[model samples]
Target: MSRRLEEILSNPEMQYLINNANNIENIQKYLPILSELAKKVKKHNTWFIEGLARCRVPYKDIEKYIDLDEILIDNCSIVGNIEIIRQLRNQKQDYQDYYVSSVIDIVCKTSEKTLEQTNKIEEYLTEKKYKYRFLPPDIYVIEFKSPNIKIPNQFGVYRYIDTEIEKQNLRIYFLIAAENNIIIRRNSIIEVVYIENFALFSLLFKFYRYTEKDKKDLEKYEKSREGLEKIIDKGFHEKDLEKIMKIFGKEERDKIMKKIKSYVDSHPDTIYKKLLELNIWFYRAY
Candidate 1:
């Protein structure tokens, strides 16, 4: 039993074991002997808050593989309600290390998607007997899989200096379990139609490999802007607009910029169209 517990403790993701104990007092009541497990960590490196998934681990052995300072996880949960817990580090070399967990609410997309193959993945994980015990109950639960996708190295997640705006990399995390807990683990990459990362050329390469685009729509318009913007009349942010205009020495490009701005001011939600409009000024993620 001690060997299993030690093995569980040595897991890289086990810093928040006891704190994730469904009910700390209740867990302690049943696990009266857990207190004597011997403190491995000089201080707390990871903060596991209540109602959040946590992996129980021996902080002593695994510190070599990971860094608590860089933050192993910001907040990882499988049961919906996306409030996340963060890892905290103390500056002192004294008092061993004590970590107290805290919670905060922030708005971010959880990559909610309706995927068909999702059930195939979830069902596979459930039947794998991957179950382990944190206390008596199962610690980790497979919430659901993200869309059936893989980040193709070629997805256009790049950009050049010619671009007016830096391309964004569409990064995401996968929820996973280890040592009987729903810890956030890097699983497969999120396969997206349009990548935000600045590797457009790479993505283009992948596009050819997948060359199985018999059914894939390439000419469809991309999702346009769904955001609000500052309204301007015949006048506008001349300096800012000028900066954009300077990118293209051609007057034709500047003329197109004006047309794009007019479209943006009117539609306010045609970001993709606006992007296309500024093809000269805008950059591709390469």
Candidate 2:
């Protein structure tokens, strides 16, 4: 068995909980063990939580351990236990955090429609309250948090931006996760969408073929290839290119720009298609 499965089974209490998930008496007897498993085996804790929900354990009992958003999303199905669903709905309504509330709203609303298809998720995004954009397959939402916020243990790519509002700078971040959820924090965000699991070599080859040019100059700046690819993926913004130039120095910047301009001039159609792809991936987050 896989190490993760073994770890779950190794804990006899956890194993009992999973086995008797539909038994409310058993869940209540080992309730404290659920919290311990949540802390110890975080990656697989969802299984235990799902069991609790399925068995109709009180939401308040599980709320202290598992995240509300996680439980709601993981078990947001009409087939899911109705009492647990009602408890989660009440909990969601009581949340004052805008991001959390909005996320719950999106998931609950979309789940009402259908959770089995991507197109169904896209269909209900027309609501004015939360303007969610439809991301293509393999593209994911990346959330950012302002530095002033005291959110701890947050993880993602980090980028800094300068703003004139109050003469203070903000440290923006890009939170990449395995879900297609939108997370907004106090109206401060940098960029939202990125190519999921981007393959550098494959993108480079596509770039070369699109430009219909030799790879000599591209290979010359081996160190800058990744940076260049990022710029292109983000739709060849001048500011992004300038940032790359600032990091790699002016000479390398000029060469990179020259190569890109040559490609744009030579293959306008190809470049336009790329920009369209970017537009479809990125939407205004409000």
Candidate 3:
């Protein structure tokens, strides 16, 4: 066994939990041990969350989850929640990174699509004597694989192992283990798609690549409101309506118009520009 594996195996608290697998209550009894283990393995420089998952210690403490999250998010190059695309406009950008921007395409739990394939993957792992375990909802970890095999060049890190029938190149790691089938490499291109999973409570995946055009558009939108704010601050000029309509799309213009109507009914002398300014500020405040 590698030194890393030895360290995990030799952990007295971890051994206690594994040996007492017959009793699920041991998890709560030994959470502090598990939290300590999480801190130790966190600096491994990968997102595997390795040792904690390896020992199958289910931590139930919300604070412990927050503590672990602080470690992972700090180290990740980029991270984002999985949500409806339409909701993104209203959601604030929650991110911290050392690099510019890149969106990584990730496909997870796709193996669960068909029962037959899921069984096949389990059988494959058994045949290879792979050390692996399932973390609730969908995360599956492959702990032990044949050593000394060369991993692909573009592969930044192996985050998770999933059952993928069709092989595709993704910046995110997805591997289905087989004898003499470990080698993998493919075209590194980016495409955006949205998939649904209601089981997860919050954001699960991280997007790595953001195109120049995408970044420019986001920057433009952020700065776009400033000029419009200035125009609205002056007075209700006829040209102000034209300017506000051009800055935002139909939905936004409709909102502006509705607010303007309400404001006109209340303050007859106030300009339509005041309504437009309030509408823009309302969304920005979020």
- What RMSD, rounded to one decimal, does every model reach? 23.7, 22.5, 19.9
Q: Write the residue-wise lDDT of candidate 1 on 9-99 in tens digits.
A: 5454332443343212222232222322222211212222233333322222222222322322322222111110011112222212222
Model 3, 147-170: lDDT tens digits are 321112111112233322222211
**lDDT to native, each model:** 0.25, 0.29, 0.30
Candidate 1 segments exceeding 4 Å error: 1-211, 220-286
Candidate 1 TM-score versus the reference: 0.17
- After best superposition, candidate 1 residue 33: deviation in angstroms? 25
Report the Cα lDDT for residue 16, model 3. 55
Query: lDDT of candidate 2?
Result: 0.29
- Please count the clashing residue pairs in each candidate, in the order shown: 30, 0, 5
Instruction: Give the lowest summed-lDDT range of ten residues in model 3.
Output: 198-207
Distance from true position, residue 45, model 2, in Å? 56
lDDT of predicted model 3? 0.30
